[model samples]
Target chain A: MNIFAPVGRAFFTLLAQIGRLTMFLVEVVSSCFRPPIYWYHIGQQMMRIGYFSLPVVGLTAFFTGGALALQIYLGGNRYGAEAIVPQIVVLGITRELGPVIAGLMVAGRVAAAIAAEIGTMRVTEQIDALTTLATNPIKYLVVPRLIAAVVTMPILVAIGDSIGVMGGYIVSTQSLGFSSGIYLKNTLDFMKNEDVISGLYKAAAFGFIIALMGCYNGFNSKGGAQGVGAATTNAVVTASILILAANYFLTSILFAK
Target chain B: MTTPKIELRGVKKRFGPKVVLDGIDLVINPGESLVVIGGSGTGKSVTIKCVLGILRPDEGKIFVDGEEVTHINGRARDKVLRKFGMLFQGAALFDSLTVWENVAFGLIQGRGMGRRQARDIAVEKLAKVGLGSEVINLSPSELSGGMQKRVGLARAIAADPDIIFFDEPTTGLDPIMADIINDLIVDTVKDVGATTLSITHDMASARKIADRIAMLYKGKIIWHGPVSEIDNSGNPYVDQFIHGRAEGPIKMEVRG
Candidate 1:
């Protein structure tokens, strides 16, 4: 037997998981046509993954937008052009920081919670109980979170983008010596609708990643309390990394011009 | 008198070098209660997991209603699952849902009943488990352990399943509450006339609920007999386990 066989097998297993995730998307898409949706479960997940996420996303966006304005104004001031702060800050927040930061914030908050909650259920055999009750564990447990993530993410990003732009406007008009109307007009003039749309699309993808990582680690969790803690940690770490990586790929394509 | 609800033959499961179940054989006759008893980590839970298809065995055959069900998946596995109910070890009521909602989950999700109809059944089952309608709207976490177990029991029988699996049904209950739950199990199963395969190290529960008892040791069933014949099983392993002795043929592994 080859000495490197274990390493090769581990790589193959990762590939297999990715392949299965692809198949799972197909399954979820098909199920969208099926009637009798688990509305209650979906609503519950929305409260967990979406509504509770607002504070973290909002605070992060506000601070990030403020910091961006300060940094840009300081850098551009050397050339006697600190006036472009609003335009740059709005574009930076809407096109990049808003979605990416929101994604990372959600990864830290929601993903770890999902992993811990579901991992506890898995270790306690609640998932098995769902199966025994003739409820498909994936459809019942996973699909709700996925649907909530997909549906709520765009909304969160939209909110974050608006709030972040406002944050930049606050700093620009007050601390940076730009008129409110001029700052607003500059942001509108410089950025197109494509930036906002692109950000929302990335948010949706990040939501899927957050939910997927949470469910995967939770579902495959082993041992008990220690295992659940580990799964929660892994879910957050993996989700944050993937969100950053996916953000880079999305940005490249969206900003290719 | 009727066909067996579950049958296992030469069932074995192993993880790396550790074997959990080894060459097991069992039959659970329809409408009868069969309890598997053993010390901690003796594969009682593993046996139930194998039957539920949560954990697949390394080798064996499992039959439900005389049909081979070991290797099935997707729709086939679901079809098999519809015949069963389970009460988990820790009262696995979804913390997110209300007590009534958890009980009605299978009815609404699996059977596609309207919320009104499912909630109606949920209330009725909860009443049967001695939980009032006032408690129905409350989250499961709000309830006490015995009450959570009651809710779990209520959920298990909510679908009126043809078969039921209860894992450590009374692990954390007081003797009176344990007896109450045991009695409820007996009453509800009789009302539905469901086949049950329960696993518990609790002899009082086994004696109260099981028509027959099987003792597991070192991943195999070393002794099995009618509950009426348990004390006289003449098997040292069974004696060591059921009586909670630390000596005899079975040695308690020293934890690191």
Candidate 2:
């Protein structure tokens, strides 16, 4: 009986946390549709969450695309089917590597930043002051980030797809003895619009998850510097996990026959 | 006979199993300066938070100008909040914004005023707080502690609110600086003619700024009176608190 008590408490705590997160999500989504949307803040966040993320997202996708091409070529060598490298690289980069890598990287960068910034505001009484000053913290703080991430994520993923395919093209034409024109042709011909569109859809969902987790953890952070540190760590960890989990579910749903 | 500017009726609040504000009833007339004094963790801050709608009371009602405002939120609460300005304990200036921008935040974000007009008003308010335009472009972090508090004071009064709150307005400054801040607060509240509520453990500040003083103890307003009558209140708790003594009915909670 005594042993079961701790388990029961832990279960209840998890349920409470889920309930709180769900409420926060509903509040943020509702606030997004309300009037007085801060266009300036949205533009600022887009620059931060999307434009600034390009370098890191592009670099990660490029390296991953090159590595995927190498691995696929080697695997195809065993079966005497190395001719399939360009086609597979194009398919894999468009469908999986671009969205997933970009999502995870942006989650690490943007989510951590949002959490740290908002967490500092929370501990310092700025949030309460906002309330007193007739400003809604959710509308002023959370909604802009949510809107920017949702609107800019697909653009980021699209650019990542192009850069990733180019990475595979460079690797294939330069290192794998494949001709540039034929490899480009194979890459272009093998890619379908559905693959790219599906990844973009996944990217949009990942963006929402990243912003939601970041804002939620930051809003609820207590104490001081230590509390903010915990919130930042939690934002990154939760955003990454949710992106992967959401990716799996989205893949099954989007691709199911 | 006129309705009280602010009223808290049997308001109560608690967190988890630890009760912070058990029950409180307080009032301030229009254009009056009321200060709440209590030792650390006696719920002085929570009382102001309850009225400002920053924290919802678990029970009872709050009224501003004779209208019930308890439990109101969203735009309705924002409407009520329009009447308020507050100087926080640590100033709480937005570090991301320059000094003028921090002061102008309420005007621009709340009233939808243009940036240029707001900046002019911010400059004007900063002048009232004894800060010059030289500090306008610098971040809050660049200013000294006393200067930050002044900027915070400027921000608070920027909108010309009908009510103002001062939360420990002189916590971390030198004695001379604290006196200067107290004088600024007195002058600004007078100029704005706003009903003022201040909470502090600084007895000197309370004495200087309060027309009426209330002492909170164990989550209740145990004693309250005009500032002149505070010395003759005949309450042992008030006596111990004002003289800054540890030996009295109020025992320090020493946790091992």
User: Which residue pairs come into collision in candidate 1?
Assistant: none
Candidate 1 residue-wise lDDT at A45: 93
lDDT of 1 by residue, A51-120 (tens): 9999999989998998999999999989977888978897898889999999999999999999998899
Badly placed stretches (over 4 Å) of model 1 are: A1-36
Interface RMSD of each: 1.2, 0.7
- Which candidate tops DockQ? 2
List DockQ, one per candidate, in order: 0.68, 0.89
lDDT for each residue of candidate 1 in B1-256, tens digit (9 for 90 to 100): 6777899999999987998898999988877899999988889988998998988988999999999999998778978888888998898888778999899988887777999999999999999989998999999889999999999999999988899999999999999999999999999889888999999999999999999999888898888889999999899888877888877988887781
Q: lDDT (0-100) at residue A64 of candidate 1?
A: 91
Which CAPRI tier for candidate 1?
A: medium
For candidate 2, the clash count comes to 0
Point out the worst 10-residue segment of candidate 1 chain A by lDDT.
Answer: A28-37
How far does residue A115 in candidate 1 sit from its true spot (Å)?
2.1
